[model samples]
Target: MLKAMSGKMCSSSSILQAQKLVDQLQIEACMERFKISLTAADLVRYCQGHRRSDPLITGISSSSNPFKDKKTCVLL
Candidate 1:
């Protein structure tokens, strides 16, 4: 249900799209949490810099040739 709402707002799993939604919600939540209104750009910049606290989010790092001549373990 929530996923549908989120996807309708923008592309699925897009950083910019998700950031836009977060910024919109943050304005209301931030005011209640901090007693002030913060702009979307400011919020986006802050969140990008401190991603450790991000909830229910995962980031991927990939490389075509990540390792050379490395024998990785395999599970039977």
Candidate 2:
């Protein structure tokens, strides 16, 4: 799906046409899902790093993640 869209985006003659292709592809939703998942992973890493020296907080961040294969999430 993205590969086809990429070709269309590249072949687009004008900025407006490219923008229209992006809109038709719903790229914003894909981008937002990617952002949320990446942010969640980063947050987990940060908390684990900070908690290492501060024993007051204890938790584990798993290297194995179920969402690794997930491509999209529900948009809020």
Each prediction's whole-model lDDT (CA):
0.63, 0.64
Clashing pairs in 1: none
List, residue by residue over 51-70, the lDDT tens digit for candidate 1. Answer: 87554354433443354445
lDDT of 1: 0.63
RMSD to the true structure for each prediction, in A, is 15.7, 16.6
**Model 2 CA lDDT for position 58:** 49
Per-residue alpha-carbon lDDT of candidate 2 for residues 5-72, written as tens digits (9 for 90 to 100): 54564443566686898897886667545578889999999988787666346433344444464466
Off by over 4 Å in 2: 1-34, 55-76
Cα lDDT, model 2, residue 32: 43
User: What does the lDDT come to for candidate 2?
Assistant: 0.64
